[model samples]
Target chain A: MPYVNIKVTREGVTREQKAALIAGVTELLLQVLGKSPALTHVVIEEVELDNWGLGGLSVTAFREQNR
Target chain B: MPYVNIKVTREGVTREQKAALIAGVTELLLQVLGKSPALTHVVIEEVELDNWGLGGLSVTAFREQNR
Candidate 1:
């Protein structure tokens, strides 16, 4: 069983985009790893800017400092 | 760096439950693998019943069939 988790900043991603991402990732795994689509699970997670961290700082704070 | 993702069907999971899961997982990794807490990332994903599939049927359909 192959389970894939995709994490991104919670930036207004539409349901259509999420569906496409799931389908695309599933297909890629099937093509590359010969995984069965039935056994593949794809999950997308959108994190709030304040919750996601990078370089010891939250994404929101990092962006503020960088910008 | 460790990235852990936990997914379950979108039942009514309270914020406290999610927080407990994240904390419990992160602590487990740190204790078992000696991973750094700062470098550990835990994400919880709640999936809709219709989106999750099992045995060639969506979870919704599978539940209905079983019930």
Candidate 2:
């Protein structure tokens, strides 16, 4: 099975919001990517503040570094 | 940008073979998943014997455990 797992920080999202986002992502993938819902696997890992990064910089540190 | 990175063992594969496999995988994803080659990203990481697992067991350990 080809599974797509997305790991992102959940700083501002609640569980319900996360679920809705996942559902939307799954729907988009199915419609745009043509993947069957049964065969497609989507896993979301919500990382804490200290564990997320972007452009080779941790989110918090990057914000601090920029400030 | 959504990228699909596949990490697998390179125990029995040559460099050329690995490239071929990646190309084949990308093609399959494009045809079967209907993902555009431009937006789709694929990365392959080759793991050594000590760093791989399957069915809750290390590959070598699993083979040994089965014996």
Candidate 3:
């Protein structure tokens, strides 16, 4: 059994969207990895925008710098 | 970015085992899903023995029932 955790920026996503995303990912895992959905576990966490970083830059800063 | 969460019975697993499990699962995802490790985020949570249930039975009870 594989357990998966998902963390995302909560600002742009709705509760329904989050649920759909989880379900979609779960399906993807089953379809792609040949794993059983019932045996898999998924958890979602929403983190603050400022806390997320990419390439040593905060997501906010990365967006601004790229823009 | 695909974020994966892993929840496991932490009782029998050591800290090193946990880290290895994460790395193994992460590698499995990358190898199986063609995803970038940098883009994937994984979180591991250890739940109490009483909290995890499988097939409508708690892990503890399931083991007992099976045995």
Candidate 4:
């Protein structure tokens, strides 16, 4: 079984995008490892920028400083 | 801020598995890194065995008991 958990900063990702991501991951797993799509599981998590951090700074602050 | 995402091949994991994993991970982060449980997010994704692989063999085929 292939389980994939994708974490991304939440920024209004559409349902279609989520579906495409799941499908793409499934197809890629199948092609690369001969896995079955029916047995693949893909989960997407949308995290607030404030909840994500890099180098001890929240993603919110990181983006602000970068800009 | 700490966000934890766990992916596991699904095989009828119990409710205890969900609770224990989330709680344990949360506690670990708190103890090790001083992350607040309130700010921590834990998500678990379960994949089917047929989709998982090792050394180019699907877990389904890899398991002799499955045959």
List, for all models, the DockQ compared with the true complex.
0.16, 0.06, 0.22, 0.11
Which window of ten consecutive residues has the lowest lDDT sum in model 1 chain A?
A14-23
A-chain TM-score, model 2: 0.64
Model 4 residue pairs with clashes: A1-B49, A1-B52, A2-B51, A2-B52
Badly placed stretches (over 4 Å) of model 4 are B1-66
Model 1, which residues run further than 4 Å from truth?
B1-6, B12-45, B48-67
lDDT of 3 by residue, B1-67 (tens): 4566766554665677656655665565565445477877767677776678778888789879889
Q: Please give, for residues B1-67, the per-residue lDDT of candidate 4 as tens digits.
A: 5555666677776787567666765665455445578877777777787776765777787786557
Specify the poorest-scoring 10-residue window by lDDT in model 2 chain B.
Answer: B1-10
Arrange candidates, best TM-score first: 1, 4, 3, 2
Best by DockQ: 3
The lDDT values for all models are: 0.79, 0.54, 0.66, 0.68
Residue A49's lDDT within candidate 2 is 52
- Give lDDT: candidate 4, residue A25: 57
Which lDDT value does model 3 have at B49?
A: 64
On residues A1-67, what C-alpha lDDT tens digit does candidate 2 reach at each position? 2255544455554666556545544454454434355644556566675676656877688779889
Model 2 pairs whose backbones collide: none
- Cα lDDT of candidate 4 equals 0.68
DockQ measured for candidate 3? 0.22
Tell me the deviation in Å of residue A4 in model 2: 1.6
Worst 10 residues of 3 chain A by lDDT: A26-35
